[model samples]
Target: MSGIILHHYATSPFSEKVRIAFGIKKLAWQSVDIPPVMPKPDLMPLTGGYRKTPVLQIGADIFCDTQLILRELERRHPTPTFYPGLARGLAEGVAFWADHQLFGAAVAIAFGAFGDKLPDAFLEDRSKFSGRNIDRARLKQQAAVMQGPLRAHLGWIEDALADNRAFLFGDAPSLADLAVYHCVWFVRERARSDALADYAGLNAWADRMKAFGHGERSDLDAKAAVAAARAAQPAPVRGTVMPNALGLTAGAMVSVTPDDTGRDPTVGELVALDAQSVTIRRSAPEVGEVHVHFPRAGFILVPAKA
Candidate 1:
């Protein structure tokens, strides 16, 4: 638990959110670069099946999803807190909007703008993950349709920053700031052209978020990361009770799968189940016995055979 390992790749907006979180906390971490797409052979054993970018690892516990990962990091390192006061709720709400609405818009624009230039295989692979048929023609059409809404969202962000506060909820940056910033980063950075070039306010805010930078990161190979997990022991579960609502027990065999497109399930022995999250113990030759934790939201945990 002393060392923090991040399984992520560069150019991922969500990954940037975690990297910046590390910087704010000033935590030392090892970075394991992963594929931008699935078939994440090295990471699947640790994650079970959740192939989302930028998973956080500590010893034998794997924390997937930025929401859970951020919370765990906050619990471990309190200084330079990510969310404070009313900002916590507000930030979470903003982040939710950013993740869904803003992020969707950004992706449409990102892919639409570059779909033609992108390799056919890459686009085809991503389409599978999205659970949608994507083509340059479709992406271009969606990109045009999304532009108006995307700009309107940017305008709201611009107005929010017009109050002259250094960050979203006062001087220090909060979850809202980072969440919003990453979506903005994706569109502007991904689009190449100034998707927000005219928005002076947003540009300035992004500069501040950029200043935070990613914390000290050293490279580690995929094999080394897996080996590290194999050698360590799963951390003791903090929750004592399992949620009765799921009609599940402590040792039930279950499969955890995201409700969205990337629906591959991670089969394991249920270790702990609560309203907030679910933990499962799975063993593989590469990752050995490890506990994988997935947030209850956006995921379904059902009997393995069912």
Candidate 2:
């Protein structure tokens, strides 16, 4: 019901990415700290099924996935652009490498080094992942396997930085910088490893991103966030037909929900829709008092007849 509501937990690398973006954009947003693990009852009513971390909620509109969220933010505020014109493609390429490749290796190292040291409180919050304890020894072995690939990637990043562009693309900070920051922050905060210190340019870039400061980030308990979400009224459902990008016909009673992870899924009567996204209304309290949205690309709006 506020300007921006972010449902996320502390120490989530992806969440941190959005936090940094908010800081860079200088936007004030509400914080809704979701459970680190499963049984996210409060969040479910909004996302329907998608459970990925760091969901962005605006009024009744919920945006899942950090990439999509970032895109929305960019569309809203274009000044400090994350994708600066010609560099957009390059920035996206770097972000992809960082999210997939770099994050893969960073996570491997983090669990390998701090699996045991992880706070009991944090571990307990992850009820879903609680029983599946990490085998540090195995994690270490996995780290070894990942290390070579990560190091090679870092070396490539280092060479890019050697060009003295300030940011990965040059001059101003971009999405690539934020993606890289979260991974490096994970290594420093969780892993406590200075392995990246050897990469001077990368280190310097990290420092620059850090200078942005995590804007308006205040701690909120998961229960509190859930309570706030429950108390909040769902946005009014507009009667206009939604565009159909999913090849569904108007009047098709399909459930427009996010993909399962734990996040709330948006469900409604399939009105005007498209292959990209679908709009739904909360006809039942189970779906909450809000209009729900789903990306046709990622969700399945199964026709009620099926």
Candidate 3:
């Protein structure tokens, strides 16, 4: 059985976060490249309706959301902890800000200031999605709104950097540092502007984090990855359920699937259960899958009404 399979796309910022974590932990994992847009047939059976990037699959168990995935990775591998003891609370706060606030700002800038900088090929690739032009316009508007908040947030981050700590919390890098680093990386790489140039400390911090190369990151075509996943047999469903503490149930029928661009299955019968996750078995040949699980807390599971 594969240890852990990550379904994600290259340009996804959230996926970048998990990729970096994999690098930090020095762990090897199977990579499943999902589409950047919708029409995700193969993935939906695993995720049900959640159409987010970067879903982690372990055997029959599927994990969505980067935050939960991070915790799971930490639990599986304790060394190089993302949540250092002294700065745990601070780290959590920073991560929250990055995922919501910083990411929001970065998205705005990505669509507004740096849209042209993206290679024509990149744009063309994304153009495959319906209503590409409309999406671009909306993204630009989002960028404009994000710019103001991001600038203010950057100012605050500058002051935080002034504390002379090697990281957000001290000499050691914490989840906060990584969260901040990836958001900044997206801005710098995608925006290609000096929006943050004025913040010397922030620049230095970003440079330091860059030294930790995301592990085994290579350009694998999205189509190829999907094909490989299709060719490979769905891993057997383990009877074990994600712990109840995680908040999933047994007997609830659900179709475990991903949310990106792949078609495998539409629905499945959710069987094996626990507090944390529920297992889904797909009948569709294209979606023939087993033990698709979702985190109880992050996902909504409505009992199949008779």
User: Using alpha carbons, what is the TM-score of model 1?
Assistant: 0.95
Q: Which ranges in model 2 have alpha carbons more than 4 Å from their true place? A: 118-134, 218-246, 250-287, 291-305
RMSD of 3: 5.3
Per-residue lDDT of candidate 1, residues 162-231 (tens digit)? 9887888888988888888888888777677467789888899888888887889889888889889989
Q: What CA RMSD would candidate 2 show?
A: 4.3
For each candidate in turn, the TM-score is 0.95, 0.78, 0.73
User: What range of 10 consecutive residues in model 3 has the weakest lDDT sum?
Assistant: 257-266
Candidate 3 lDDT: 0.66
Ranking by lDDT: 1, 2, 3
Candidate 3 lDDT over 193-253, as tens digits, reads 6777788988988887777767664444434444444445555555664545435455445
lDDT against the true structure, each candidate: 0.84, 0.70, 0.66
Q: Ten consecutive residues with minimal summed lDDT in candidate 1?
A: 239-248
Q: Candidate 1, residue 57: CA error in Å? A: 1.4
Give the distance in Å from residue 20's predicted Cα in candidate 3 to where it truly belongs.
1.0
TM-score of predicted structure 3: 0.73
Could you tell me which 10 consecutive residues in candidate 2 have the lowest summed lDDT? 257-266
